[model samples]
Target: MENCKQEFEEVDVVFSKTKHLTKEECTKLQLQDSRLVSEFQASKLEIDAKKNWDLFYKRNETRFFKDRRWTTREFKELVNGGKSCSGKVLMEIGCGVGNLIFPLLEEEPNIFVHACDLSPRAIEFVKNHPSFSSDKINAFVCDITTDEITRQLELSCVDVVTLIFVLSAIHPQKFAICLENIYKLLKPGGIVLFRDYGLYDMAQLRFKAGHKISENFYMRQDGTRSYYFSIEFLRDLFTGAGFNIICNDYVHRRTINKKENLDVPRIFVQGKFQKPS
Candidate 1:
């Protein structure tokens, strides 16, 4: 058993090798063309964000994203010693196809989940899933930017809110409003767990010249928008909303495809912010 454990550790070490880039290198890699926005296209994308997301779900169904299995390891408070959560409440803000929530439910059956998404189709998929229990999971449609979240959930009741790759989808101008709504939904001591694209990530650098919508934001060919964030910007946004940062850092990983001869570095900014008691 000890030898097997050692072998696994060595494998992990080999795969975890990452290459860090300097600021100059990253700047040079970003879309070098002028960041210009076409008013017509910008307006269309903003208005059709929901429509685009709905189409995305209709086309991909529930299979596009892999289940996130790292939550339990990253946020230990979600489960207690491989057992149940003892009934902590969690809200997943872009709960697509029950990925994070379902895995978490499997781990801690006693915990309750409030899952919301802007796409009704995504919520429908979650509700129809075989493991979905109406008693334990409340699946609803909510637009954090415009909807009154309190109407859907009791104010100051959530214990933890997970925002995994959700914020990057919204327009940067509305980020503050979205964060403010999330702030009101959490209890005085509630925590917000965040993980999203970091500035100059490979995905960001790959955008073509015409796709740049604004500084660090772009629209993909699919009509969905993505915004890359810097740690300082995220800290300011969360702190301005009255949350105290518990932990904030960039998570860097390198993926190597030997067959394709490709080595890609991915950077993601993750944070845990607590609403002060």
Candidate 2:
């Protein structure tokens, strides 16, 4: 067991060192490191990533997501006498570290949230968090694909379900399955708001030519997986899963700091779908 642990630590170190590689350095590492190449080849990296995500939140939840201090201004505006959230339930599918969960709670004190994720570590982190509360924010460890969370728990259907930076991590084919399940739990006229990576973001372009795992999906050196998505596919998935499209917008943003050009590319695709009231 000790030998196995040492070997695992060695592999982890290699993965960490490879993360900051320049696009050129990335190519060289891919070429020179046969182990890394084989790890990429096996395609079991996604399963390996479940552990990686566990380690990630365990080690860096506070520094990485900074969930404790996050608040969404738009959510604040919307809920503080805004049109949508006066007397509605809200759910965030992958409420990692409770960034969106706690913020949305702070925004509209009256609304309740049923937040879930597949990672038990993530759920535990949220549950034990200083600001966490069972009444305002109910965090659960659940894999929506296999788990009958909504029915088993007897939590009522939600008014709006938020999927923030989450759909990009799932197997692309399972996207529909996820959407269908969420739709089943939403009241008529409920919305699914998504904020995630768009195509050609920095993460997508990091792929070595051989690292491609079927279209826009790729495995990073750290065993974490990512998928880049487009607006058209997102719209189709929601509509096919029994949602009527109300609003779909693509937003482009930039940062302004003197002497530095920060053209960080992001796609904000907001969708408001109703179940035919």
Candidate 3:
């Protein structure tokens, strides 16, 4: 339950739901819907703050990911795939306080990661981390829709676009632009690896009526927000932007409070979107 709250505060994304992918009609519908998109007209997009990300991490840091509950084993599989990241330049969108970045370095220490976040505080913490490497991990402040970071990462020349938990925060209208920017940054055939909240997880049901910011989008009392997604919407968004959807699936999760006999539902979507060769 609190995973929802922590999810928002950590990097501000999540709203889970999904039907069985095997359902024939549902699968067909998801494949054909192009105009489908969520509305987040009321959400905020700016992350103006001081250069230092210390206070930001201090307030939101958690050992949760240290348990590896959220990421599963997909990271290692791709990182060590037939294609290697040994000399590749990678860019991570919505990279919070180095939670995902530092561990990635541990996997392939020679590879460099160009990462950004809207929050200055988030960037600050990542820049100042103990494993922080000017050569391997370049942390910076950026907003995907408005910032010019492509030139800063020119030396690295991005080969991969990592979108872990990033898309849901963006206002709907800007999503296309976000994809466009990623495409521009990436080398041809570059892979965009991503994972985020799904459609009808318990978190979405927890929202009271007034919290709804738009269809399938909601804001908590905290500044954090979330958007539930249908698989079709994601396919259309990336496919229309010229990326091929290689893998997309819904994962159902259940959390148990053994002592209290409580079982909670959670859902997540994971995908590999690839630019054409």
lDDT of each: 0.84, 0.63, 0.67
The TM-scores of all predictions, comma-separated, are 0.89, 0.76, 0.76
Q: Which residue pairs come into collision in candidate 2?
A: none
Instruction: Mark the regions of model 2 whose C-alpha exceeds 4 Å error after superposition.
Output: 1-43, 66-87, 154-156
**Model 2 lowest lDDT segment of ten:** 9-18
What would the per-residue lDDT of candidate 3 be over residues 1-277, giving only the tens digit for each residue? Answer: 3554332222222223465444654444343243222244352322312222334456766432452333425754346564565777878888887777787677667677888987776777778788888988778888787537655555225777789877876656678888988887878778888888787656765665456666666655554667777778898999989999888777666765655666666787878898887
Name the better of 1 and 3 by lDDT.
1
RMSD (Å) per prediction: 4.0, 10.9, 8.0
Arrange candidates by lDDT, descending: 1, 3, 2
Candidate 1 error regions (>4 Å): 1-32, 80-84, 258-260
Q: Is candidate 1 or candidate 2 better by lDDT?
A: 1
The alpha-carbon deviation from the true structure for residue 110 of candidate 1, after best TM-score superposition, in angstroms, is 0.8
Give the clash count for each candidate: 0, 0, 9
Candidate number with greatest TM-score:
1
Question: Per-residue lDDT tens digits of candidate 1, residues 160-209?
Answer: 99999999999999999998999999999999999898877788877766
